[model samples]
Target: MDVAAIVTAILARQAVRDPATLRPGMRLDDLGIDSLGRVEVVFAIEEQFDLSVPFNANTPDAGGFDLTSVGSVIAAVEALLGEGRG
Candidate 1:
C-alpha cells in the first residue's frame, strides 16, 4: 500500500479537505484536525494497514510514533510496517 496516499486520504476525510491539496509538510492542526479528528485518523490508519499505531489521544507526544506532519505520519507508518517484517 502507498503510505502517503493512504495517510493523505485519511487526513482529507477527517479534515474535509481536498486530498490533492494535502501536502507532506502540512501540519494536522493547520488542516483543522482536532484531537477527535486525530483519533479518527489513527483508527483509520490502523484499520487500513492492519497494524497498530502507537498513539495516545490524551498525550500524543508520549508515544514514539511521530504525528507532527503528514510526512512524519507516512514515515512512522512505514517504520512500523518495516518493524513487522523483521
Candidate 2:
C-alpha cells in the first residue's frame, strides 16, 4: 500500500493513463480531472485504504484533506494512518 501503488490504483480507477511520473505538487486540474472524477477517486481511495475520508465541497478544509494530486492524496492517507496509531 505504498504511495506509488496507491497512485497507480487511483489512475487505474479513474481510467487515466499512468503517466511516466507523478509528484505532490501536480494539480488535479492539470491532470484533467473534473469534479465527478475527483469523487470517484475519493471512493477508490476509501476502498483501497479502508478509510472513511470526509470531504465538503462548501468547506474545502473540513477534513484537512487535500487530494489535489497523487502525492497529496498519498500524504493524506499517510497522515490518517499515523493518527490512528496515536
Candidate 3:
C-alpha cells in the first residue's frame, strides 16, 4: 500500500479521529495519541513498507520521525522509503 493508505489504516486501527480531519501542523496530543501510540504507528509503518526505521529515546525529537500529524507521518515514511530505495 501507498503511504497515505498505510497512514489511514494506522489511524483507523488506533481509533484515531479520521485522517481527513487532520492537517500537517496538528499536534499528536490533539489527536489523543500518547507516546505508545506513536511507537505503534511507527511499527505499523515499518511493517507496511517493509522498512526498518532507526530509533532511540531521542528519535522522535530528531527530524522526520515526528508523528505529530498524519501528513508528517506520511512524509516521514516517504522519506524513509526513498532512503531505502536509494
Candidate 4:
C-alpha cells in the first residue's frame, strides 16, 4: 500500500480538505485536525496498515511515532512496516 496516499486520504477526511491540496510539509494543525480527529487518524492508519501505531492522544510526542507533518507520518509508517519485516 502507498503510505503517503493512505495517510493523505485519512488526513483529508479528518481535515475536510482535498487530498491533492495536502502537502508533505503541512502540519496537522494547519489542516484543522483537532484532538478527536487526530485520534481517528491514528486509528485509521493502524487499520489500513494492519499494524500498531505507537500513538497517545494526550501525549502525542511521548510515542516513538512522529505526527509532525504529512511527510513525517508517511516516514513513520514506512519505518514501522520495515521493522515488522525485520
Candidate 5:
C-alpha cells in the first residue's frame, strides 16, 4: 500500500469534523483530529499495514511515531516500511 495514501485514508476515517480538510502539511489538530482520533488513527494504521507502530497515546511525545501532521505520519510509515516492518 502507498504510504501517503494509507495514512491519508486513516486520517480521513478518524477525523472528527473535516475529513476533506486533510492535507500533507496540515497539523492533526487543524484537521479536526482529537486525542481519541489520534489513537484510532494509529490503531487503523497498525491493522492496515500489519505492523506495530511505536505510539504512546497518553504521552505522544514519548513515542517514536509522529502524530503531528499528515506528512509526518506518511514519513513515519515510510521509514517503517523501509525497515521491512510492513
Candidate 6:
C-alpha cells in the first residue's frame, strides 16, 4: 500500500477532518496531534504496515522512530521496509 496514503487516512481519522489538508512537511503538532493521538497514529501505522513501529509515547525519542512530520514518518517506514526489518 502507499505509505503516505495510509498515514494520511489514519491521521485524517484522528483529525476528524479532510485528509487532503495533510501535507508532507506538516508536523504532528501542526496536524493537531497530541501525545495520545500520536500513540494512536503509531498503532494504526503498525497495523497497516503489518510491522512494529518503534515509538515511545512517554518520551518520543528514547528508543523509537521519529514522528516529526508526515514525511518523516513515511521515510521511517520506507527505511524499515527497505531494510527488510518490517
Could you say which candidate leads in TM-score? 1
- The residue-level lDDT of candidate 5 at 33 comes to 85
Clashing pairs in 1: none
lDDT of candidate 6 over 1-86, digit per residue (tens): 68778778888888776889888888888878888888998898888888777777777887548888888878888877777753
Predicted candidate 1, C-alpha RMSD: 0.9
lDDT tens per residue, model 4, 1-86? 77889889988988988899999999988888877888998899999989999998888899889887888988999999999999
CA RMSD of each candidate after superposition: 0.9, 2.1, 2.3, 1.0, 2.2, 1.8
Question: Model 5 over residues 1-86: C-alpha lDDT tens digits?
Answer: 66787788788877753445678998899777889888888889899998888888777978788889999999988898888844
- Candidates' TM-scores? 0.93, 0.78, 0.76, 0.92, 0.85, 0.86
Q: 3 or 4: which has the higher TM-score?
A: 4
Deviation in Å, model 3, residue 31 alpha carbon: 1.3
Candidate 4 lDDT: 0.88
Worst 10 residues of 3 by lDDT: 55-64
Worst 10 residues of 6 by lDDT: 77-86
**Candidate with better TM-score, 4 vs 5:** 4
Off by over 4 Å in 6: none
How well does candidate 6 score on lDDT at residue 33? 87
Better of 2 and 4 by lDDT: 4
Give candidate 3's error at residue 45 in angstroms.
1.1
Ranking by TM-score: 1, 4, 6, 5, 2, 3
CA error at residue 65 for candidate 6, angstroms: 1.2
Q: lDDT of each structure?
A: 0.89, 0.72, 0.71, 0.88, 0.83, 0.81
Off by over 4 Å in 2: none
User: What is candidate 1's lDDT per residue for 33-80, written digit by digit as tens?
Assistant: 888888888899999999999898778999888887898888999999
